[model samples]
Target chain A: MTPKVFYISDGTAITAEIFGHAVLSQFPIEFEALTIPFIDAIEKAEKVKQQINDCFITTQVRPIVFHSIVNAEIRDIIFASEALDYDFLNTFVSPLEQQLGVKAQPVINRTHGKAKESYENRIDAINYTLDNDDGQTMKNMDKADIILLGVSRCGKTPSSLYLSMQFGIKAANYPFTEDDMDNLKLPSELKKNKSKLFGLTIDPQRLHEIRQSRLENSRYSSLRQCRIEVKEVEMLFKKEKIPFVNATNHSVEEIAAKILDKTGLKRHMF
Target chain B: MTPKVFYISDGTAITAEIFGHAVLSQFPIEFEALTIPFIDAIEKAEKVKQQINDCFITTQVRPIVFHSIVNAEIRDIIFASEALDYDFLNTFVSPLEQQLGVKAQPVINRTHGKAKESYENRIDAINYTLDNDDGQTMKNMDKADIILLGVSRCGKTPSSLYLSMQFGIKAANYPFTEDDMDNLKLPSELKKNKSKLFGLTIDPQRLHEIRQSRLENSRYSSLRQCRIEVKEVEMLFKKEKIPFVNATNHSVEEIAAKILDKTGLKRHMF
Candidate 1:
């Protein structure tokens, strides 16, 4: 039987889910996972505890519960359930408090709350990325924290959005299209902001497949065209001495992280 | 002196950062955080250990180190550091392994790696959201998982993008501009997809402030205009019997989670 797992928190439960998922992924087995977010009140915590107990009664197996609940009352309710609880928050909070000589002033929703200035800055970054996306305007390239260059659909948009949304980075992207293949070079605006330039390349076969999904049987999706565009864009990157990465095997998280790592860009955590 | 914290990981260190941030947010006092990612080798771990030791020697206070390093040898190196270690991964891994009666098969980058099909689906959702954003076209409303309606800059675009990017929900947004306020009614496409329609409202003062930053001293940024638009759109939302939330006090994470909670949308965890 697949093991059951629960990610519980008084807030959004995003942290619990991420930490639980990371730990579970290390094991070579699947888990039937459920997330219970916003368990702020005692009643809600009781109901969740009842649900966990019911699952154990039916399955004859103790469920693995991972929670980051800040409220002591609500957390105690979960801890009393018929499951092996991994209290992610309190496990470290006491030790941290001891080390720092400060008591934790636990507040619900603080983990994901909008810290006013940083929140507004994040919104600004998102709007900046959208306005500057897809070479829409080279006028604002100078303001961009990073500029991603690639052929069409080489994961530029998602990577750019991820950077802005997750890390509060003002990311602008430019596409080196099939038309630019003949004499592919940086635009004057991009050359002026050359220090912010980063290239993303994909395997030609993968690029062809991605294009085919959007515009099937078109010259844009053809294998020959994909090969040519990738070659020319990669050549331009090499000649210009721009750092690049292959996006074919990496997810948006990996791609964004790699870019930040290579560029030494500071990731502003929310 | 602020307590120094380090989030160290072999891969992106995103999980480490998130978990550490969540844990640290419980405290009232501020902390200085530094993230070091891609620490896969013993040599890299040793260097990080040296850095942590240097921090301790300089401040006469041990830094708090939170790491999710999977490799035992590399992990041991960090464990030898002078910092107060919080081994997020291994803390629960041993108990989980015993509970499951299986050894963990630790692989680097699995948490955020491209698990091909889901990664593709995420990209598709992002594209769908972008194509259908801001009522760009009513044609694709039938295909969206959620449709957000609000006045201009009431947090529609960012919320919609967050829904798609973080949760893989195809969220399309429509703005009720000043023109729409005169006859605030849902479009036919939106009326037909009423079940998916979610409304966002904001406080007039906040709306005015947000708009004033974009267009200074214009009628569009006037407090009166902000109040009128919000009133009309909210009235329309009530008349149409659409579910809604106030976006003034919430972050994108909170808004997205609230939407999912109300809509019963399954969060497609990447």
Candidate 2:
């Protein structure tokens, strides 16, 4: 088997899948994709070195590595990792050329960009669905590119999947746990990915009303808990530099658009 | 466990999921959903009956059953199976409605009202994407209400998912197997559902060319074998009274639209 390219990025996996899928889609080469998210360049350096060595022993061709992420810590990690293994590697030049030059392949990249975002959004939605549907396979939705920080029963999963299905965005979401309210801090990862972070909050009374249907007791499903999560989470977002949207009584389209607008990401025309 | 209300159907699991999901999405219910597809309605009738009997032994609320399927044979099997043991069964009003009505809470039937033709187109599209997308899971593309169909690698899944991502339709597809070719007939069930049937055929040379990329030297990848399958299978469609579309050198959109036009089904308006 030919040694497949290793695309290591601190960016969300959806982004990696988009660009990786793009290259694979065009070229006829065996590919094995591995993703490590939330790694600042600094955090990625050591792991990147190990991945390169693993690629060499496992396959026949030189490894192709692509890294596209915004975290400076991860950027620093890539720089150090690259310095450590300078041989047996080649960089993708087109992305740089496109960034610097005008005549880049627009259509393909546009699809990749769209797919990347969509994949992220799907992940977020899947996580939300898992949380709500079966409460199994639940991951920490906090580290998501877009932590759908909303009430217990809002249409987080559908909204997330809608975002992914429509735009291919890597979206993750965390229902505000009671701990978040008492301690009053977004998860630590959300704090780290603060600029790229987004919050989804819904009305407290509505939250209580929605929850009332599920739990046997209306006490825990009271307006008090709903009010508390919404108020505390919003305050936490303010303190942690996270942007958020009020999702109470909003359709999935409206809520998703609000996040895109606040973040200034042009809704990819689907 | 509360005696759950299950809406089981014939055809693909995606259809079952859509129906199950849409039902849950609209109302507040304390029932767990277990919907399986690609199995005939008899399997569903039996399983739900067993489940309902189990609940009868434990719970006070009777199981509310909702089922939708096109094949009259399957309906006979379900009615016969359920009539013996199950007392609380409310049948779907239209198999087409269960499959089509997007927003309303469907209580009695699943009918798309020419929606099967629409779904058939979507299915054709899904089959195309399935044969093509490397490892990408286009599972959510069930919303594609139409699918294009033909031989192996005839742009079915891609077109279906494209229709879905492009235009929120639930699409699915089945292939013309060697058996279907030699026998020159759609499955008996598909024959009665002929109004819902749309066929896809392509130039042998074009199909052979597409296969060459995946399996280089097999006779299946040869234009001769391609021609044999295309000719023989198409003849069967003609003899069995089914409609088909020729697919050669056309974009997926064009082919899907052609199928839509020929089937006389209204295109999904986004």
User: Would you estimate the TM-scores of all the predictions?
Assistant: 0.98, 0.33
- Model 1 C-alpha lDDT per residue in residues B140-160, reported as the tens digit of each score: 999999999999999999999
Best by DockQ: 1
Best by TM-score: 1
What lDDT would each prediction earn against the true structure?
A: 0.91, 0.48
Error of 1 at B79 (Å): 1.2
**After superposition, candidate 1 runs with Cα above 4 Å error:** none
State in Å the error of residue B160, model 2.
4.6
lDDT of 1 by residue, A1-270 (tens): 998899999888878888898889999888998888889899999999999999999999999999999889999999999999999999999998898889899987788747987798789999999999999899999899999999999999999999999989999999998788877889999999999999999999999999999999999999999999999999999999999999998889889989988999987654
Instruction: Chain A only: give the TM-score of model 2.
Output: 0.47
Report model 2's interface C-alpha RMSD after superposition on the true interface residues: 22.1
DockQ, every prediction:
0.76, 0.01
Candidate 1 deviation (Cα RMSD): 1.2
